[model samples]
Target: MIASVTNAATLESAFNAFNEQSALLESSYRELQQQVASLTARLDEAQSARHRELLAKERLSEQLANTLEALPGAVVVLDCHGVISECNAEAARLLNQPLLDRPWSEVAKREFAPVDNADGELQLHDGRVLSLQRRRLGRDLGEILLLTDVSETRRMTEMLARQQRLSAIGEMTARLAHQIRTPLASALLYASQMSPGDCSDASPGGKVVARLRELDRMVADMLQFASGSNQDDEGIDVALLLADVAETGSLPMEAASRVAVNIADSNLRIAGNRGALKGALLNLLDNALIASGDEGRVDLGAWRDADRICLTVSDNGCGIPENELGRVFEPFFTTRPQGTGLGLAVVRSVVDAHQGEVVLESGSQGTTVSLCLPAAAIPSAQRAPERGFCHA
Candidate 1:
């Protein structure tokens, strides 16, 4: 009976051990399932974050492309090898050539011509000016080029410079006029007071007085030009004005016979500053006489053309060089050795003040300068009393 009880006790111990092992395996399996679920959720979150990052990067790339295309100035991208790889529409239009895949050096040579004395600028075949700038992308990437059309900008700069120079000249001319007027008047007074015999029209004293008067008139012209206007407008009879100009003997005594005056109608009239107009005409006459020389012919003619009164000075001497005609009215520009370079400039100023137009035509044949002024009504009287003639 004791042996049977011992065997039962051993069987019960084996059954308890087997039941404990099964419970431990079930707990381990449940923990493994929870860990797998957690891992799967983390993987999904990572994939979603990666997708969002990719979309943001794509949007940024698109914005950069749009900005590049919207630029006004030309933009060109060159490969590391100095070949034009890409460009905007403006680049193509400005360069006006097929630019893709072309060597930069070749394009520069083919489409661009270097401007004289200008660096970093080039002129195209069509005369448009472009300013160029180049920047390296990196040591290994390539370079970017920026080109801007500066034609209008350059023109405006040149115009402003010219105007500034003219302003300076006007100031200097005013000072010069002041300095010259006092002595010139004193000399003229002295010459006028000479003895009666020496003061005859043919005498040397008379000639000296005439020359002094001419000098005084020239000073007045300088002042008028510097002041920018005559400031006095009146009815001027063309015939009487021409008669006075002829009587003034502006032409040298030797070349007096070379001048011929033609008046279409003695009744034609113009409203302007009498002294200013006289000076302008005499100045033109002197230029014509000089151009014609001692033997050549000069014609001072006036006529009515439509609503305008046309006054012309023509010469048979060696004509103005075609290239110089354009610059004749520019201040301080002249071809003569002793020229003050103010004659035509003064004429232009006077005409502008009077609201007139001046045109010059020249060639191997000869030169003709025509001044077109608006025709004015004839005064009720024969002449409007005004300041005396400039050269009288």
Candidate 2:
């Protein structure tokens, strides 16, 4: 009986150990199940995040495509062989032709024949101007071309430049007029001292004095222009105007016996400053007198010709050299050492302001200058009263 009990005790110990191991195995299996469930949840979250990221990428790509399509500037993609791969609507419109799958060389030849650089300006046959630029996509992808229409912009820039030049010229003219007016007025004042009195209808001597007074008035008018105030916006009597100019601008009575004035005495009125017209005519007469040597005859005529008032001055004196004729109207150009070189330039400026034209003809025998004024372009101001006292 003692042996049987020892054996039963050993068996009992083995059974207990076996029961403990079974419980441990059950606990381990439960922990493993929990771990697997946690791993599965994490995997699902990762997959959902990846799906959301994919949708965001797709939206971004769509937006980029839409933005590129709506762009106004031309956009073109070129392949490694310089062939166009794709282009936007703007590219076709700007080039005025289809641009897809075309070689860049062919496109350039058709559109920009003289093009030598990738980034440059293209002047189309139809007068459109374009600024072209390029971008390298990558070592393998080739290039991207961008073109912008610059035709209107370039035209505006040129117009602005012309306006700037005109403004500069006006400023210079004002300054020059001011500098010359003082001496001219002083000289006229002294000349008037000789012919002291005025006549109603103007005496032979009185008319000469009247004409001198006109010179004084012209100085005032020029001063007004220099001071930036518009002067002489009135119609002038062409006949009386010519009479005063011819009388005062001629040589002294004794020395001018050989000089003949051939201008018509019509009372036809035209738009202009009386004093300014007198000044211009006086300049022409003085030049004529100089060109005609002592006792040489000069002819002056004025008439209407085909929508214009034409004035002519001819002198039978040494003619200007043919090559030098073109430069006569340029400022500070003269063959005479004593000449100011500004007479013809001033005349040109005045004629240009009136929208008129000038023509000069010369040969070995004589020179003829023609001044043509448009019949219209009158000032908006009312007609000025008869040329009486030319003061404020």
Candidate 3:
């Protein structure tokens, strides 16, 4: 009986301990569940935040790509190996081809012509001037190059400089003209008096008179060139202009027979100084005649091209030397021994004053000079004289 009671007591005590441990275990399990739920919520939040960040980065990357494409100037990126790694559309357009993976040196050699005495300034085969700017991307990365087209700016700068030089020359010539004309006139008068008897070109007195007259003409040309063209907004008739130039040119009979005039529209008119235009045309006609010689043909054509008047003087004879063509319009530059060297310069000044452009083209066959000027409308009341294109 005693042993049975002791066994029951031990069993009951064990049962109570087991109940207390089970309750403690349940409470701990609930606490663990709560911690797991909190962690899961935090994880979800972190994932959401990360997704938002990724989207924002993607958007930023797209924006940067669009911006690069929208840039007007070229943006080229080179790898450490000096190969074109990436480039904008403008880079391809300016370089005139695809630029990815090509070596920069090869592309430069093929497409770019380095400007003499100009660092970082290069010219394309198409005659575009590009100003290149370079920057290092970072350590061991590569380089970034930015190229901007500067052809028009360069042309304007050169034009301005030339105008300044011409202005200075004009100022100096004005002073010299006064000093030289009086003595030149006195010498001409004395030469004329001495040459009263024999006036042939072969005679000594005649030669003196001829040389003096030539000098006088040269002085007159100098004064006229220095004066430049007046800003006269008079309407000039093209037909009448050509006729007057033909008459004034006074080409020899043999040379005159080879001249041909083609006027697309008889009513074509231009707004400029009449005398200046006429003088310029006469000079070109004279030059074309001289180039064509008596056996060759010269063509003078005028027509309305777009909003401009297109005039061309072409000849079939020995063309100007390619090397000398660049300096033909420069004052005091000439290949002819007796050339005044101011004829073409005067032509240029006159055209510039009228806001016109002149271009010279020459090859082995012949030479042609083209002039473009803004066309003008004739007044409603002023009727253009009737005329037809003629061949001389």
Candidate 4:
């Protein structure tokens, strides 16, 4: 009976210990559940924030795309190889073709002839003008070109300039009238004396005729200056044009022989009015000859440089005075008593029409006049025509 009693007590004690262990395990499980719930809540908030960020990014991207499309200028995105990758509607219109995956050269690159140093523009084959700019991709993925149509701007500017020039010309014409009257009076007086029946003094009839011819030349020059190039539609070979210059450039063949012609490309040519060009060059050559006086040699050369044909006339003579150099190109300004002062002015006008530049450099050693003419629409074997240039 005592043994049975002891066994029952032992079992009770064991049950009690088991109950205590179960209670501790239940408490730990509760803490673990709380921790897991907190972590899940934090994760949910993070996911919500991430979703909102993604939506904002998508909206920003859409806005940027819309802005680029709506811009007035043409936007062309080019690949690293300079190939067109994407373009806006304006770009398509300006290029007049699909530009994707095409090389840059396929696009028109002809620049509009600039009126001054500040104007920047390009010309299309159809004669439209555009202003262009470029932006490089940040990581060097490619480039973005922005082109704006500037034809209307240019046209307005030219019209205004034309009006101003007309006003100036009108004033100059009045002065020219006075100049003409004096010469006409002198020629008439000379002609009256040398008439066939009423001859007086020892002045030969040839003198009267020469005076008349001088008047004719002056009229012709004025007419040419007033109306530049009757029609600049003819294309003339550079080589042949130089040969013509050698013939018409007032220097005697022996004096002309002293002019050395230097040009590497024979096939180069220019589109222009040949007669007007010859007349302009003749004036330059005559001036150079007079400066050289009958002794020193004048060097004339034409050569290709990049996209331009450089025609240069150099004289080893008493150079123009430094103070007077600035006035060399001014109309009606001359150092020679018999000079009308329109020679260089005519040269500049012709070059301006051809979209070229005239540069004059002088010092005690000599004077050099350089004409930079843009190469013709012809290929790179290329270039132009100028008055002082001659061929052997």
What number of clashing residue pairs does each candidate have, in the order they appear?
A: 0, 0, 0, 1
Which portions of model 3 miss their true places by more than 4 Å?
1-7, 191-228, 231-278, 293-316, 319-392
Predict model 3's lDDT versus the native: 0.83
Residue pairs in collision within model 3: none
Model 4, position 308, has a per-residue lDDT of 80
* Model 3 worst lDDT run, 10 consecutive residues: 247-256
| lDDT, candidates in the order shown | 0.80, 0.69, 0.83, 0.73
| Per-residue accuracy of model 2 over 3-116 as CA lDDT, tens digit each | 999999999999999999999998999999999999999999999999999999999988987887898688889999999998888888777676778898888779864645
Ranked by TM-score, the better of candidates 1 and 4 is 1
CA shift of 211, model 4, Å: 6.8
Tell me each candidate's TM-score: 0.68, 0.43, 0.68, 0.44
Error of 2 at 378 (Å): 12
lDDT of 4 by residue, 139-217 (tens): 7698989999888888899768865774576567556856776777777677766667634333466456545655655
Ranking of models by TM-score: 3, 1, 4, 2
Query: Pick by lDDT: which candidate is best?
Result: 3
lDDT of 1 by residue, 217-262 (tens): 6677667777776636688887777767765645356656777777
Off by over 4 Å in 2: 1-232, 263-267, 376-392
